[model samples]
Each structure stands twice: as structure tokens, then as C-alpha cells.
Target: MPSTQFSLNIRTQPSREPALPCHETSEQARELVRGTSLELYSDGALHGRTAMVAVEDPLRITVSGLEDIILSRTPGDDEHLIAGHLFSLGLIRTPADILGLAFPDNDPGHAVVRLRTTKPRRSLGPLPGGPRIDPEGIFRLRERFEQRQRLYRSTRATHAAALFKADGELLAYGEDVSRHCAFDKAVGLALENRLLAGVEIAMLTSRLASDLAAKAAMARIPVLCGFSAATSAGMELAERRGITLIGRIGRDSFTIYANGRRLDV
Candidate 1:
């Protein structure tokens, strides 16, 4: 529980807003799995062995001294997760909106984000449409997404989210104990690096839920693809936001639940 801070100077037009200090800090542990021994009964014989299990911990996000959310996630990419989460929740429009981000010295699990604006900014309207993505491109993106899940391969207890260009160029990948955290981390990376300026799509290993679809919309991603099923609410949200939501993406087939205009067979 030590405190370390790094400052990033962001250039902006002269304004009355006071400049706030930004701190970048991270936890030391980045491994996704914890080693523990468990007793197993296999082939009618007692077998005691060591196992690697997925790690989960609480991450508290405080935004501009007003709204806060606590998430249970793996111990890496915490800053990205918080940034992405705030963006996904429509709390901030751009990365520059965040004036400062501080990780608590006494607690590695807590983060405080000071915003340039005093009040949360809500999404004004539906996201704009993007270029068409080939159906094959969606499958290719899913394949790449699966290949990037190092944590899941090790512990079989993680979910992943990957960002790709409309033409299927992979941009960033994030993995975590939960689908939401994984997606948030990926979006956060894109935001921090200004990688989302191009038309983009997001693919996930978990089921497509309404909230997840909403997050994609908030990020202004035009397409969302998942290897699993999609909820009815998810479809509704996607349609309203002009985001194409594709689910049940298999090797040979897939279903488009909303905004089919964005995808071409």
C-alpha cells in the first residue's frame, strides 16, 4: 500500500478551469491466476493438487466527487478500466474531460477521477453509423478475440473484449474476471491512446447484455459482436443507438440483432 504518482500534462485552450494534478499508479500484481491446492477425487482415488484460479478484487471508481462505482475485477489495467467505465456510463465525453486520476496510496483498489466539468455529461443522441463490415470480418474478429484471451487459457475463468477497425484490424484486447471490466479496459486503452478516432467494432466472449450494448454506444463504436446470445434489451438498445449488434457468432453462422445495415454478407 504505497503511493506513487505520475503527472501527464494535457494541453488545452486557456480557460477558467483550474488545472488539476493527474496521477498514474498501478498495483504490482498483474497475474490473473492464484496458486492454491485443492483436494480432488478422480478415478475413485483421492488426489490432492495445486490449481491456478482466477483472481478477483474490488475496484472502486470515484468520479468528480459525485458518482462512484465499485467493480470486482482482476488486478491489472485498473486505470484503463476506470476511464473506460466512466466513458461507457456517459459520465465523460472524452479522455480530456478527465483532469486527474489518482490511485489511493493506502488502497490499490481505489481510484479517484477528477473531471474538468463539475457535472456528469450525458450522451446527447444516438451514435453515428459507420461503414459496412463483412460478415466474414465479424467471424475473423471473434477468432482473434478468442486467441487473445491469455488469462482464460490459463485459468478458464476470464472473459475478454477486443477492439477492431471496421475492416477487422485488431486494435486492443483486454481480459478480466468479468465481461464488463474486460470491455471497459479495452475501451479505456483506445480512449487513452486516441485509437477510437476511426470506425471501430467491439467483440466479446460473454453474452451481449443491454448494459454492455449501451457501453458500446457510449463509446461511439458502431458495431458489437459476441460469441454468445444477446438479450432482448440489448437488441433494443443497439437499435436505438444505431449500433449493429451481432450475436451467436459461430464458425459458419451468426445472427444480427440490430442495425443490419452496417453489415454485409
Candidate 2:
């Protein structure tokens, strides 16, 4: 079975029992799954290494588009991920436009979303309309981003996904070898916990591109910010999908590639 199939139920030896802080001798332990570990050696001397593989829950999403064409993918939660991705991309304005959500039986990896209005779809283009952060906001984005690089600090992992509000409050962060998985896990967690709607920006540690753009589009995110360059496809999709793509973000500067009309300041 894939590691994602492992149940989250961690069993512990100690059953529920009251603990006394005043006790002279006492034992307290928390249940945890032992992740993979490695014993290293240098010149016959012992070295230490350990690793954890987070469980990934694959989900499917079904979207009912024009002409009765139903688009479905293992997008996890159809309503939440779609709403979340779309909100982040700026293609949607309110949740009321969503007609309803449908999860088809036996499709373990997907769900379908139905919309009330069929807005005219736009082709991908350069950054068009969305809120833009000033230098102070950009500075804060970099500072908070630097502090969240713990995965890199510990394991030298390359990809990370961070969630931020329009005001720039850091919400959640995760890292993975696969940029898709990293953002997927972030979006998955947010959907599982019903927090996707509140996110205003998804700050990615990877380049702004189409795949990421697709993920963000599925979630309806209004803005996607990256520290790397944007791909042609990514730029195109962002424009087509009405998502603001921010790329080449530096410590003291950044560039807006799509939907510049929406950036108020």
C-alpha cells in the first residue's frame, strides 16, 4: 500500500488516565509513528539521520462545465479546492456563484462542482487585474518566507508552499520534494479543515508556472507569488484564468506578470 494509505490513528500504550503534576515520579508520552530512519557511518564511527514521509490523501474533483461536459480529476474536494483555488486566482469574487457540489460514488479520487453562472471564460494573458503589494508588503513577504524555510534548514528540501492572507499574515507552510505535492498538501489540509476560502495569496517557493497555475486555478486563488521566473505557459494560464502571477521576487523587489489591473497598491 502507498504510504498515503496509512491510517492516522497512532496507538499509544497508556490509556486515558489523569496525571498529577505534583507527583514525584511520573511518566508522560505521546503516541507517534516512527518514521524512516537511517544509521550513518563515517570511518566506522556512528552518524545519525532520520526522515519522515507524510501521508498524501488523493482526492478527485468533478466540475460541470458548459454543454454538459463534466470535468473530473482526483482534485480531492471539488467544492473546497475549486473554490479555494479559484479564490486565490481571482477568477471568482463570491462563494454564492457556486451552485452546489457533487461527489460521485465509487470515485475515490474526485468530486464534481456545479456553478450557478457560466461566466465567459477569458484567454490566458499577462497580469491583468488584482491587488498589488507595496515594498513594505514585499519586504514582509520575504522576511516571513525566510523564517519558514525550516525544511531547507533541516533537510535541504527545495520546494515549499505557504499560505498568506491579503494583509500578509502567515497561516500555514509545508515542504516536499515535489512542488505539486507540497502545494497539494497545503491545499489539501486547508480544504480538509475548511480554511481554503480565507486564503488570499499562495506564496510558492518554486517558479510560477502552468502546473502550479493549474493547481492554483483549481483552487481559485486570486494571486500566486513566486521567487522564480514565470513560464510562458504559466503566464498564459494566469491571464486566461484571471489569476495574478507575481514572479522574480527579490529581497527588495518583485515583478508582476499578469492581471496588473487588480493590484490596487
Candidate 3:
């Protein structure tokens, strides 16, 4: 794949986008990732050090009139995860289909979502068009996304999914142990705030696999970029779904895996 270098200057700006707040207790949030004291054998000396590790837990999703779906993900934003998962599977058209989420008093990991959708459970077709991303803007958004990944920075074991406006505004953010779950959480956040339609670009901290690409297509996000790389199936899916897939993003340039014409070419 070829990389591009656009000659536009980029600038960092303050966050003005709407972001959903996690309503969980701080202690519960902290439990998602914990710090462990361990021995660090660097060079030739062994020393005690505390390292942060992401905790992967099971989340059981129960949707109305459907079978249960279980996911192993970091223990936060369970509702958003379920919403995004359902949306990706075409179970419900929009967040409006969701009536409410009920969690067991004994098990916060289990979520039961009541669906009041009148439409069909499955959907078809490619995503809509309107997003145009500048290569320069990609670098800027990558910087901002990295700065916001507090858990990833501390643990380096978490993946993240972020949705950005074409102009570089971050619309939503999701971090988790699973790349797919991260993307779903971000989409779920956008859906909750009714901002999914306004989303232009989706960024992933990990590689762009078929699952993430499919999720982006299902969520109707036009562009999907990854910090690492894009798998062959992911590239094909993005191309078929009218998505511009970008990968191997570096400070100076990024590789366009498919649908370059949709970019600011």
C-alpha cells in the first residue's frame, strides 16, 4: 500500500466535542484496571515496581426477543458495549430501539436491554457518504487520541476506538481489552448521544480486522483508520462498504489500504 503526504499544516485545538461520561462509581471504574507490584529486571538489576494491568471480565448482554451474547472486555461501559454490539449485528436500527437497560442488583456485569423497535432486526446496504479526511488532520487526531488513552498509556494492554469529526474533533472514545469491544463502545457512546450520524472518521488503536471494519460499516462511519495495520479481510470489507480504510498511521504519513478517493484526494 502507498502512503501519502499532504502539504497542509495542522494545529492542535481544545476539545469542544460532546463526550459521554461513564456513570459508574470511581471505585468501580478503578477496578477495570489495577496496578500490580512486581519485580522489574532491567539491565542486570532486579527492582520492585508497580505496573498497571487491564482486567478482562465477562459481560453478559440480554436483548429483548433475542438470545444472550457474552463478551470478554474490560469492566466499564457495559451498556454502551451492548448497544454497539446489537447495532453491529443489525439487531436494532437505532438507539431508539432500546427502551432501557436493567442490570442485576447482584451482578453488574449482566445487562438486560429492553427493545421496543418496530422495524426489522436486520439491515442492509453500505454506509452513507459525507466525510472527507485530510491527511494532516489524521496526524493531529492521532496525537489527541493518544493523549486521551490513560489506561492504555499505563497498561499498554488496552485497545481503543475513537470517532472524530472531519475537522479533528473527537466525538466519542472507548477503551477496552478487546479491539472489537472498544469500537463497539465508541459507537455505542455516539448512538447514546445521537451523534453517530455526525461521525465521520473512526480510529482504532489496534489493527483493523474484519470485525472492526464490519462494525464501522454497520455503524455508518465513513472512514476507519488504525494505528497498526489493516487485515486483508478488513480492507475488502471496508472497500465494499464504501468506507475509506487507512492504516499504519505515522507522524508524517499514513498508508491507505482502500477507497482513497473518499479521502481528500
Winner on TM-score (2 vs 3): 3
lDDT, residue 92, candidate 2 = 44
* Model 3 bad stretches (over 4 Å): 1-30, 44-46, 117-120
Clash count for each candidate, listed in order shown: 0, 52, 0
Model 1 TM-score (2 dp): 0.86
TM-score, prediction 2: 0.54
Overlapping backbone residue pairs in candidate 1 total 0
181-224 per-residue lDDT for model 3 (tens digits): 99888888888777888899999989988888888877778889
All candidates: TM-score: 0.86, 0.54, 0.84
| Span of ten consecutive residues with least summed lDDT in model 3 | 2-11
Residues 1-265 of candidate 2 have per-residue lDDT tens digits of: 1122222221132334311111111121211122567777889798787764332334444445534323322222233334544434444444545455443553434445565555644424433344555545866877788788754554454477887777887765655555665676567456544566666688888999898988777666778889899999999988888888888888777888987655666
Q: How close is candidate 3 to the true structure, as a TM-score?
A: 0.84
* Cand. 2 Cα-lDDT: 0.59
Please give the lDDT score at residue 161 for candidate 1. Answer: 92
Displacement of residue 35 (Cα, Å) in model 1 is 1.1
The lDDT of each candidate is 0.78, 0.59, 0.77
> What lDDT tens digits, residue by residue, belong to model 1 across residues 1-265?
1222223233234444422234555445455577788899999999998877888889888875575789999877777777788787667666778777777784667888787775656765787758778878776777777777777887899899998888778887788899999999898778767786663888998899998998887778888889899999999999898888999999989988998887675
Top lDDT model: 1
